[model samples]
Target: MKLYGSLTSPYVRKARVLIHEKNMAVEFVNEDPWTEDSPVIGRNPLSKVPVLEIGVDSYMFESPLVVHYLDHVDGKSFTPRDPAGYWQSQWWQSLGQGIIDAGIARVFETRRPLDKQMPEKMQREEQRIHRAIDLAEKTIKENSEFLLGNRYGLADIVMGVAMQYTDFRYPHDWRSRAPKLNQWLKGIAARPSFVDTQPPGFEPPAA
Candidate 1:
C-alpha cells in the first residue's frame, strides 16, 4: 500500500497519524501537487493529496475516506458500535472536516496576490473557524476526555489535525476563549501518534 501527499497537509497528516497508531505497513509517497508534473494527477485527477493506492490501479481519494479505510483495516474498528454513539462520532468527524475546510480556505486566500485577495471571504472563513472551535469546546465539555467520552477515536484524530493545522498555517488567538478545547488538544498532542506526525515547524502549545 502507498499513500501520496505533502507533509504540510493536515488532510494527509490525518492518514499518517492513524497509520502510525495502527502500525500499518504503508509506504508514504511525498508528492507536491503544486508542481507542474505532480504524480497525484495520475491517480487523482483533482490533484488532491492523501490518495491511497490500495491495490493495482485502485485508489481512494479524500482524507476522510482514506481515514475510514485505515480505521477499519485488519478488522479493527475506530468507532463506536451503538447507533447513538456511532452517529455522534460521525457528527464530530464531519464538523472536524468542516473546520479544516474553512482553515484551508483561509490559508489559500492569504496566499493569493494582495490585490486579488478577498478580505470579506477571509473574514467569513475566519469566523467559521472560531465557531467550530466554540462548538468543539462545548462537545468536549459534554463528551469528556477526547471527543467521545475518553475513548480516543478517529474523530479526535481529525479534530486534532485540524486544530494543529490552524496553528501552523493560520495562527489565531483562540486558546483562551476555549479552555476545555485547549486542554483536550494538549492531551491529544502528547500521544506518540500525534507527536511523530507533526508537520515541519509545528510547535505544540504549552500546557
Candidate 2:
C-alpha cells in the first residue's frame, strides 16, 4: 500500500500514525494537494492528500476510512467491538475531525490574498476550533486514560493529531486552557508512531 500526502496535513498524519501503530509496512509518498502537478488528483477526484492505494485499482480516501481499512487488515483493532465503547469512540473521533476541519479552513483563509481574505470566515473557524477543544477537554477530564476508555484507540489518534496541528498552525496557548489535554498529548507524543510522524516544521502564515 502507498500512502500519499504532505507531512503538514493533520489528516494525513492520522493515517500515518495508525499505520505505524499497527506496524503495517506501507510506502509513504509525499504529495502536496495544492501543487498544480500533484499526482493525488489522479487517485482521488477531490484531489485530496492522504489517499491510500491498496493495489493497481483499489484506492481509499478520507483519513477515517483509510484508518478503518488499515485496522481491519491486521494487528489489534483500535476500534472497540463493544456497542457502548464503539459509539463513544466514534463520537470523539467526529469531534477531533471537526477541529481539523476548522483549523484547515483557517489555514487556507489566512493563505489567501490579504485583500481577499474573509475575517468573518476566519473568526468563525477559530470559534469552531475553540469549541471543539473545550469539549475535548471536558471529555478527557471525565473519561478514562484515553478518549473512549482506559485503552487507547482511534479517538486518541485523531484528537492527538488535531491538537498537534492546532499548535502548528494557530500558535495558541492550548496548554493553559486544557491542562489535562496537554498532559494526555504529552504521553501520546512519546509513542514511536507520533514521534516518527511529527509535522515537518512550523510554517505560520506571514504577516
Candidate 3:
C-alpha cells in the first residue's frame, strides 16, 4: 500500500495515525495535489491528498474512505460493532473533519498574498473553527476517557489530528482557553502512534 499526501494535511494525518495505530505497513509518498500533472490525479481523479494505492490492481481516495477500508480490510477494526457506537463514531468523525476543513481554509487564506486574501471569508472560517473547537471540548468534557466512550477509537484519532493541525497552523494561545481539550491533546500526543504521525514542519516545495 502507498499513501500519498503532504505532511501538512490534517486529513492525511488522520489516515496516517490510524495506519500506525493498527500497525499497518505502507509506503508514504509525498505529493502536492495543486501541482500540474501530479501523480495523485491519476490515482484519485478528484486530485485529493491521502490517496491510498492498494496495489497494482486498485486505489482509493478521501480520508474517510481510506479509514473505513483500512479498519475493515488491512488493519485492526477500531470502529464499533454496535449500531449506536457506530453512529457515534460516524458523527464525531464528521465533526472532526469539519473542523479540519475550516481550519485548513483559514490557514490557506491567510497564506495568500495580502492583496488577494479575503478578510471576511477568513473571518467566517475562523468563526466556524472556533465553534467546532467549542463543541469538541464540550463533547470531551461530557464523554468518558475517550471521545466516543471508554475505548480510544476512531473519534479520538480524527479529533486529535484536527487539534494538532490547529497547533501547527494557528497557535493562538488555545491551550489556556480550553483546558480540558489541552489536557486531552497532551495525552494523545504522548501516544506512540500520534507521535509517529505528527505533521512535519511547513516547507515550500522545490521550485
Off by over 4 Å in 3: 142-144, 202-207
Q: Give per-residue CA lDDT, model 1, range 72-159, as digits (tens).
A: 8777877888898899888988888988999999989999999999999999999999999988877677425778766888888888
Off by over 4 Å in 1: none
Q: Which candidate is the best by lDDT?
A: 1
TM-score per candidate, chains pooled: 0.96, 0.92, 0.91
> Which of the two, 2 or 3, has more lDDT?
2
lDDT of 2 at 169: 86
**Which 10-residue window of candidate 2 scores lowest in summed lDDT?**
198-207
| Cα-based lDDT at residue 106, candidate 1 | 90
TM-score of predicted structure 1: 0.96
- lDDT of the structure predicted as candidate 1: 0.88
lDDT of 3 at 7: 82
Per-candidate Cα lDDT values, in order, are: 0.88, 0.86, 0.81
Clashes in model 3: which pairs?
none
How many clashes in each structure? Answer: 0, 0, 0
